[model samples]
Target: MKLTLIAAASTAFMFSLSAYSQDMPGMKMDGMEGMKMEQETKQAPVADAEGTIKAMDTSKHTVTISHGAVPAVQWPPMTMAFSVTEDQLAGLKVGDHVSFSFRVKDGKAAIVSIKK
Candidate 1:
């Protein structure tokens, strides 16, 4: 009777461990939880503006542009320096007329692309 009880308890313990392994919290068994969240919280659309480059700081990877209103981001026409990637500044220069795309997050603007 004791051995039979022990055997049943051990089997139940093993089955519980298996169930936990398959039902862990924060572990997406279906693998579509991330995709569902991604589809739900859609990203803000990219915004574009036309501007003249006022200054270019290659060392800082930044550019100051006098841009027209960016209606998408509700920004007025203004001169402000924005961080840019080296690739975006490849052939860009000060005083150049260019159309650019940017995203403003956390009150800081970052230029995504620029073209004359």
Candidate 2:
């Protein structure tokens, strides 16, 4: 009689455990359908470099700047001129303080965009 009770109790416990797991919000069940996972891919945030515009040449599509340190890339503040695409050079002027994003390409800093 004791062995029969023990077997019945164990079976009950197993059934309850399975039911609880199915009700859990985070649990995934095998052979279940219609569960759509919303996974998002996030891009890396753009790094900001701030400084005063030292010089700009719209014709040459280049700008010189003396900027504060950029913490994202561990860059120290220095005065340097960078090349920009002709389209990127629009509406920029020398001596106008600005913030910008750039990446070093072929040992030269290439300007991506300028911010007022």
Candidate 3:
């Protein structure tokens, strides 16, 4: 009778061990999934401006521009002279009607490209 009881207790312990082992992979202390990870990518902001060049200053590498309203990006087009790089000024001329792509950083607009 004692041998039978011992065998039954051993079987119960083994069964409980197997059940606990099966659950080990999915157990989470904070009630979160352990094996899944997620990552998000950030996209750069782009704005399009189409306008006529009012003036060009190759010495300062800046251009004065006047553009139509850019409603798609909520930027009201206006006349302004902006600082640009020497490489950007190379292809541009005064009074040229151009469409351009720009990005805003630190409250200033930087021209990315110009298309005639």
- Writing each residue's lDDT as its tens digit, candidate 1 over 1-116 gives 99999999999999999987795587656866456566567655779999999999989989999999998988899999998988899887888999999888667788878899
lDDT-best of 1 and 2: 1
- Which of candidates 1 and 3 is the stronger one according to lDDT? 1
Tens digits of per-residue lDDT, candidate 2, 27-102, equal 6687756655544333344567988888877777788999999888777988988888877767767777898998
Candidate 2, superposed: residue stretches over 4 Å from native: 1-46
Better of 1 and 3 by TM-score: 1
What is the TM-score of each predicted model, taking all chains together?
0.64, 0.54, 0.56
User: What is the alpha-carbon RMSD of candidate 2 to the true structure?
Assistant: 10.8
The reply for model 3, stretches above 4 Å from the true place, is 1-44
lDDT of each: 0.88, 0.79, 0.78
Kindly report which residue stretches of model 1 are placed more than 4 angstroms away from their true locations once superposed. Answer: 1-36, 39-42
Worst 10 residues of 2 by lDDT: 37-46
Residue-by-residue lDDT tens digits, candidate 3, 48-95: 888999998879767788988866557786898666788877777888
Q: Tell how far residue 103 is off in model 1, in angstroms.
A: 1.1
